[model samples]
Target: MELSVEQAAELRELVNSRDVPADIATRGRIVLWSGKGRRRKDIAELLGVSLPTVDRWKARYAERGLAGLEGERPGGAREQMPARVRSRVIALTRMTPPAGTGLSHWSTRELAKYLARTENIVVSWHYIARIWREESLKPHRSGTFKISKDPAFAEKAADVIGLYLAPPGGAVVLSIDEKTQIQALDRTQPVLPVAFAATGKRTADYVRHGTTNLFAALNVTTGEVLGECRPTRNGKDFLTFLKKAVKPHAGKDIHVVLDNLSTHTTWEVKEWLSKNPHVHFHFTPVGSSWLNQIEIWFGILTRQSIRRGTFSSVHVLVKQIRDYINSWNTTAKPFTWTATAGEVLAKARLVATNMKKIVNNNSN
Candidate 1:
């Protein structure tokens, strides 16, 4: 068959393009080969399709052009799933399974089986899964939340956040915290180093040599950390670390943001604060230790240094921690806190309100 330039270009594109369906591309090839004076039988053999298949597509192209090559097969589209069935699938998915089923949440297969047995709504697990994906539902996953019960939550949070956003002139702002009971663990067998196409492996079992406590004071302005590995996390040890952290600042005023731990509020610490009038402590609200940015540094320390490290003794663990602290200070950057006090308080209030509504609904 003779072809126009436009038809030739479209056929070439359909044959070459990866996005075009395989069958459509094959059809394009058949039409192109036929236009090139190749025999229909040769085209069929080259494409590994029957001679009648090649003839059918060539007839389709001649009758309707490229439009006939695309779209659904000869028969009409499949029957639409009932709206009621989709609705029931979504509704059951949002709810917990019945008490005696021993299921905490609904899986696609389990949900399909339950619906078939109880509701007489027979459907495949794949069909139910499709509905979940369309609706963006994941019953298998869960998250955690906690609302601070401190009556002075707003005041304390505002105080700490204010320091982060805007610190007083000529005063040093530090976020201080203790990461307690860090274990010095050694794997039973030496870890296998990562190689090509393989991940590093370690024995599931470990020997615990001992534990150590790390007290860290993160300079909020410069991101430099003053950390010490102490044998204990008592008030005396915290006081010693605090003095070490404050030594470099000398005569300047120091503002410390820390959580409300018993060790932090000890009489010795109170006395030290009284004597060093330039040092001020702003405590985060109860159970809201996340407000302290030193916790962020602690997480980094755990992930990068301690979690994967092999330490035979507490001394080795302490040395590794100190080394990491030294390295971190060299390239340290301050963690930017963007959320304003009002924004944080607003979110907390919303969560509290939602919890209250849930509680009231349950009571009713």
Candidate 2:
């Protein structure tokens, strides 16, 4: 419902009026907020009343207008929600959803259905949702974590972390990585630029022209990025990028931190390493790209360039990537790594222990 100017003014007057009963004034405010598109539950919360009270006030106002608030409150009081049932709802939300439901998280509607079936209760999903909101119960999202299974996890992590915490003197430390198969997608419609009132919008459909692979090197100390976009992602391309990245710091000792990608460990890569005796490689543990700072730079690149950009062709995409690299070089700051290897190992070990306990309990 939308309020007419006169109706809104009258409600505002009631809300401000000293003569009106507090209850009547509150109902007036509820109706006013509802007319401005506020929900019943929100009105109830702001007025310190129950959902049923909000509904009654709105219903009465809709039916009898101002005259409705003239009498005693329309449904005197609400029966309390069953405390035990509320506890059951909360407990279920904390637990994993039933396997047969094919749901990893509990939706309000799903919980209401489950509760109704199991406990012989008739309750609205809205009510359940309100309860969950009050309790801050969101079982729908999960946090992510990874524990590398590499045997040299400890040694590798310490090596990389040592580079971050205490880098070798007079050496160029570079965190390098490749973002492969980046598509040049043109939106079917033009992008609407963001404004103060709204975020930018884009068409869901797009035209794919071509793809390129981005090879990037982040200078850990200086915060400079050396990048190239190649048509292929292979040992040969990586080698070419490596040669280019090292040219500026040719005489200085170079230490590169990288993931354990197949290309990074190829015979050709090894031969290149052998040729450049001054250059050293510190590979992060398997499945632990987070240990490399370049991954953080890649995230920034994706968000600022690739994610929202509309590219007509691979050439355009490459140009955008180079441009973004140039812009970043002017303002980039060295990425910080605060957690020590010991702290990281401890957290990972704790996760592993918790996971083991869960598995053991489930098996029994």
Candidate 3:
């Protein structure tokens, strides 16, 4: 009926130690509950033990203190799971199920059923799930990686990354790109503004007003974003925006990081570049848009401003974009490129190696 501080503390410690047998830990928990003035019948029901089993452990602790709790069992101790079972669980997770088994991937329930029928080993789905977690095995999920195949990938990626890390003194580094065909969309119904208890809500359907292209340049030295909404995304419009962007910074040399779009390499653009020798251009590798940090700024703008905004017409949409860019300029910090060119190239090579293995396996 009563417990000294030492006795209560010992029982609590044993209940928390995972090294002990489950039955022994349950016993310790039962005694701790009984110490809290729980009846023998209530402790037995709470722990899923019979009244007599509860009485046995409580009596043991009362008589011999902590020593009586370690009474002898049929086996000295329960053994850990065999290595063979663990390995089989991991191997099955990494493979596709058999053709006749009606399973594309191994689910925990299906695995347990398979083991019961074929291996004569019975385990609950929960036990199999524990093993899967311990081994970090997931049979139903996958990921994708791309290795750019641009013949000039190495040099192009190096040049872009170099501009980000170190630029010529007194020269402005600009990341320039265009986000085209941005729809001027109006929600079908009125939106509910956000409140403390819930998030803002918008109609799933929208009315299309039209589309416009956004040509933007991000100043790498200062986080200022300059953007123009153009009716066309042709070389002529691109050149026009380029001239406007470079006009103020005319006296200083500028290095621009961009993608290899046809409009950017047109004869007019090329001739203009030749005329302004101080204006240098470095292209990011095909399929490696992540090397350019301006795209990151665009993503932020889309999420915070454009995605949720409801525009009634092309003019309103353009004005909204211009306003967002102007506001973004007030608090712009240069995006940092922490990875070295060597590290990126090494990762690309690893991706290439993995892709080759996948291709070869598919061929076989």
lDDT of 2 by residue, 204-255 (tens): 2357899999999999998899998888898888988998999999799999
Candidate 3 residue runs with Cα over 4 Å from true position: 1-145, 190-204
lDDT per residue for candidate 1 within 71-142, as digits (tens), equals 465678644677767777776676546656766467777898898899888886646756775687766543
Look at candidate 3 and tell me the lDDT of residue 262.
87
**Candidate 1's error at 116, in angstroms?**
31
For model 2, the stretches where C-alpha displacement exceeds 4 angstroms are: 1-144, 189-204
Q: By lDDT, who's the top model here?
A: 1
Candidate 3, residues 250-318, lDDT tens digits: the string is 899989888878899999999999999989988887756667777878778776777657899999999
Candidate 3 C-alpha error for residue 43, in Å: 46
Relative to the true structure, candidate 3 has a C-alpha RMSD (angstroms) of: 17.6
After TM-score superposition, what is the CA distance of residue 358 in candidate 3 from its true location, in Å? 1.7
- Per-candidate TM-score against the hidden true structure: 0.58, 0.59, 0.57
Could you tell me the TM-score of candidate 2? Answer: 0.59
